[model samples]
Target: MTGRLFGQGEVGSSDLIREAAKRAGAKLLEYELDAQFRCSGSDGFINWVDNTLDIRRTANVLWKREDVYEFRVMDSVQELEHAIRQKAAEGSARLVAGFCWPWSNPNGDGSLVKDVQVGTWAMPWNAKPDAGHLGAGIPKSNFWASDPGGLEQVGCVYTAQGFEFDYVGIIFGPDLRYDWEKNIWVGDKKHSFDSVVKKSGDRFVDLVKNTYRVLFTRGIKGCYVHFMDEGTRKFFQSRLE
Candidate 1:
């Protein structure tokens, strides 16, 4: 599969996607975000004519925050599988887990590092379609028959909102806080600056607590968790105990 990996600022996600695609032999469908970007994630080839195609399926990777589109197209199942595997290998694979059952073996802790597919949230445990967490039918990927291997799982507090997992590894990205004095979440803010700044705004305490609760409860069997900051990590350690 191939497309113009469009994104403002630095190109981490787009670059990773492109490299992974190239490694897998998927062609890059190039088009400016401002221009009409298009592609089909199937084995059948897509012929882009200024912005037209003769394929059965086609989609646009339009971004919300930025006015950009990553024109991508896939050719074969083999290419799709390779691309997914490559995408999965985008980030760290260290299983950021919670304190629970299936993930009980501490020995397996470092096994998933190296290439982690950024799960629902920036965290790993929030990984979707996990053992028990996946709702019903598996999410349809552009390619491959199953979730690619090698990618790590990072469970986030929010995305794990109402779900459960048989075994979970939660990685607390730089996105949470706990008020030690009040025994509550200092505030609940997603990947926003308001979350880090004190007076930037009031912390969504209830939301934070509830979010953590959901993330913690996901482990029907086992869990392991990693916090991004020492402060949050200390808090999680105390709570886990």
Candidate 2:
């Protein structure tokens, strides 16, 4: 398990398993799985994400593997969505975002409400609970990651986790940003839409960071991203440069 990639308010189960074995007087055997299965098997891309997010310090301070694994930052969310749509034509692709928008239920007519809005661009969150009579091609929330109709909506971390796509489009929300003056990543609960994560007190920042770390690493072949915060976008761009 990638311990550092744990989601908001999540506690690793590895320790619990080890403790249970000790109490039962049984030896616990552990093996580290380091082989890369995601990001086109580019471990360097993963390391670069870890270092870039300040999740851990690693030798990969710069990402120079665009030829092997596609990574691009778009100036606008419109471009991000367009790119993802183009990739989806070739293979699997989905757009995901931080939990920074309230997920409203489907409209009375069974159409999803456009809740994820960025400037002039807007898209609905994946189907909500008991979303009855969805339009012809829209998939239910559970199948959003695998279904072709999923491209019509935006996926949150809850639905996107444990799912890998050939191409991923990520919207970096305002819940977390890089504070240029302080030289640190700041988590602002006021900008967060997740109630549980926002109330994490001192751990809010780490949880928010982990949430993005998970979102950013969901692509197997490429990741296209648009940041809601300019400072955060610049910070990531600087690392690539």
Candidate 3:
């Protein structure tokens, strides 16, 4: 897998974490870098008639499960920042999960976000802020803000539903769902985008498309996309025209 450049001093995505925090100008409720593993195996194990066991080439099941070092609660913002900074710089990417107060997307551009190399980008499922005057459906998530300083420092979008950023820098990891047809995000089996769709219907789909749209549009003037599905690229090309 291709590695993403993140953080300060080639260490952690914390440079990004700090920048984002600064941009939002919000305090940290909590945050940390959590470790996880990408595991998969054959679902059905078949026995051979020859007194030996043969593993059939059945469907492959892949999923991310929490690995060693379960959870490390962060006390201060600096500690959380330092931990992520350290992880982003490591040779292998480690999973990190944490909580943050809430921020509003002031800009909402996709090109502005940067991709991280070492870890999956995740935020608190409940951190979503109220969409005050921005009006509903306009995308009031903090990920949609355009902070010139923040953009130059750390670029990427890593969060959940109901958010839009001026520059979305999604860190592609093993969990991403690939759709060869639409060439867009199919759905994360782990995160269960399908369930989100089922629960919210078109409203959910619209939020996803719009969330990605906001992510794609984050560029200062244009979008720089990498490793996208053919269908997704086509969708972008068609829409850009």
Q: Which structure among the candidates has the greatest TM-score?
A: 2
- Point out the worst 10-residue segment of candidate 2 by lDDT: 1-10
Candidate 2 colliding pairs: none
Q: What tens digits encode model 3's per-residue C-alpha lDDT throughout 1-241?
A: 2224332223445566667888999774444424211111111111110111011223322211232211122333234445544543442121121111123233243221222222343232211244234322333234323222222223223432222232223322223334655644453334332333436643543444443433333222111233223443343333221
> For candidate 1, lDDT tens digit of each residue in 102-213?
2211124322222222232221232223232232222211111123321223333323333333333444434456556765444434442223232444434434333444
Give the TM-score of each candidate: 0.33, 0.84, 0.27
Model 3 misplaced stretches (Cα beyond 4 Å): 1-168, 172-178, 181-185, 192-198, 201-206, 226-241
Predicted structure 1, TM vs. truth: 0.33
Error of 3 at 83 (Å): 22
Overall local distance difference test of candidate 1: 0.34
Supply every candidate's count of residue pairs whose N, Cα or C atoms clash at under 3 angstroms. Answer: 40, 0, 34
After superposition, the stretches of candidate 2 with alpha carbons farther than 4 Å from their true spots are 1-36, 129-133
Query: Best candidate, lDDT-wise?
Result: 2
Poorly placed runs, candidate 1 (over 4 Å): 1-163, 179-184, 188-190, 193-203, 239-241
